[model samples]
Target: MSEQALTLKQSGIRWLWLAVVIFVADIAIKFVVMENMGYGWSNRIEVLPFFNLLYVHNYGAAFSFLSDQSGWQRWFFTAIAFAVTGMLSYWMSKLPAKEKWNNIAYAMIIGGAVGNVFDRVVHGFVVDYLDFYWGTYHWPAFNLADTTICIGAAMIIIDSFRSEKKSD
Candidate 1:
């Protein structure tokens, strides 16, 4: 292999490492919440009136949307998660060597997706535990993986708006 090719391989490894770190951290936090807090429970550590350390499990997509569907939904979302992870991995490989932020964003998304995918595969659902609310209305409960995925998606949108070139 050429010197440039070796360097590219090394760079890709670095990005994969980043993804691994996020994935581990995400699972670790979830494990703690699951083991200690229990499902559909909350330990309110009110950072603000609208925020709390609430624990809830989601059987489906964001906000428990479609979580009420028949048993088939779990496997369906898991399949989608695997597909997304594969696509994100591909994007990471072609990511520009100098665009560290962009690479990190892709890593975050891939890591988060894989993390939740594991839960779906193993438990047939996702364990979500963070809660945000306003007045009597409550936002969906989510975990680190979901937050990272959202951040990564936002960065991707911003990057696109900035007209960054997709490196081959």
Candidate 2:
């Protein structure tokens, strides 16, 4: 039997589906959070000793960078997220289907980026709910999108190292 060539749409499409799933889940959870929790620091529910569900609007990037700015950061971050999502989509499309790690990483990044972008466009800030802390020290609250993006980034880093090791 002869080997058949797969078209772009037939290849690496599963990764795109994963991206869609992530996007949907992210949006849905955010909606639930918005519906149940009050805006800002009003309605906080402690879920665990080191975790809480709190509503926070971040008008800036990670760790609320530039969050104190005069509101220009909203559009700026929205634009950046859109651009990154676009780039990651393009990159994912170009990858071979067998490159599972890279595909998954790109899809996750794209999904997370789009999720945050939607928040910025709709609410003028990203909605963050998950809060983790230990004693008096608290990690900045973040959402599923942020968590997925960090996981994807870490996977990409690991993939790079694996590739380098293989090449050696």
Candidate 3:
């Protein structure tokens, strides 16, 4: 029997739907948070022993890096998101449909990045609401987009350990 060749799904762009879903869900939740919740730490709603719904904004990247800058970081991060999303989409188009892990990971990153870009463009900052804490200390606030990106990044890292022969 001959070795079967992999078909990368109409160039694998099909996987991008997962990205779109993430973008839509993130934006929709942000909209809900903005419409129903008051902003700032004083307005946070305690949801559980370790979590709260806190509406806030991040003007910079992960962990609020550069959040204190005047204003240039907004466009800078937006530009980076555009470039990275484009690159990931391109990679998805070239990857095999059978490579579900990598394709889905790329789609997730694309979705999450685009969602954050939308926030940066429309609101001048990313909307963060989910807050976790340990007694007096708290993890930096984040949103669904941040969650998706982190999960996607982890998927890619896990994929890295797989034998490359699986792809070929």
Candidate 4:
């Protein structure tokens, strides 16, 4: 660990609290969904004309990719999530705490990744809710963790553009 990392407030790792918050909230919400809702398409509760609360388990990554595979994907995704969380946490620890944008973004991603990983380990699948649809077409159901991950990834991309502008 570097000198900066030794100083608790000085390191961007301070933002890890946000990650913990996100992780806890994600897990609690998943629990709520599981306990309250019956599984599958038939049990979905329409929240709005275009939205629904649907509890489903995703055995694969986003959009249920490779969800049909014979069970290996759960471990694969869990491993990848932990690797990513580790890398991001390391980066956060090295960065100055003043680097709010990237730190927050990384924290969000780390939180989401860990949340999903927990699901894979405990339930053998990621529990998904929140369905959005338009007419007969429907977008994939996802949860708060996915939302945070996507938002964090977008923030990182946006940060790249800012860095480029500053350099140029």
List the candidates' TM-scores in order. 0.86, 0.92, 0.91, 0.96
Ranking by TM-score: 4, 2, 3, 1
Please give the CA lDDT of all the candidate structures.
Answer: 0.80, 0.87, 0.90, 0.94
Candidate 1 residue runs with Cα over 4 Å from true position: 1-13, 41-47, 164-168
Q: Every model's Cα RMSD, please?
A: 3.2, 2.9, 4.6, 1.8
Winner on TM-score (3 vs 4):
4
Judging by lDDT against the true structure, name the best candidate.
4
Report how far off residue 9 is in candidate 1 (Å): 2.4
Tens-place lDDT digits, model 4, residues 1-168: 876447867988899999999999999999999999999999999999999999999999999999999999999989999999999999998888999999999999999999999999999999999899999999999999999999999999999999999999
Flag the better candidate by lDDT, 3 or 4. 4
- Candidate 2: the clashing residue pairs are none
**Which 10-residue window in model 1 sums to the lowest lDDT?**
38-47
Predicted structure with the largest TM-score when compared to the true one: 4
Q: Judge candidate 1 at residue 107 and give its lDDT.
A: 87
Please give the lDDT score at residue 52 for candidate 3: 98
Model 1 Cα lDDT, one tens digit per residue, 1-168: 998787777564358787788889988988887777745544655678888785677898877878999878898888888898888777767766566877888888888988898788877788887888989887888988999899999998988877656642
Query: What TM-score, to 2 decimals, does candidate 1 have?
Result: 0.86
Better of 1 and 2 by lDDT: 2
Off by over 4 Å in 2: 1-6
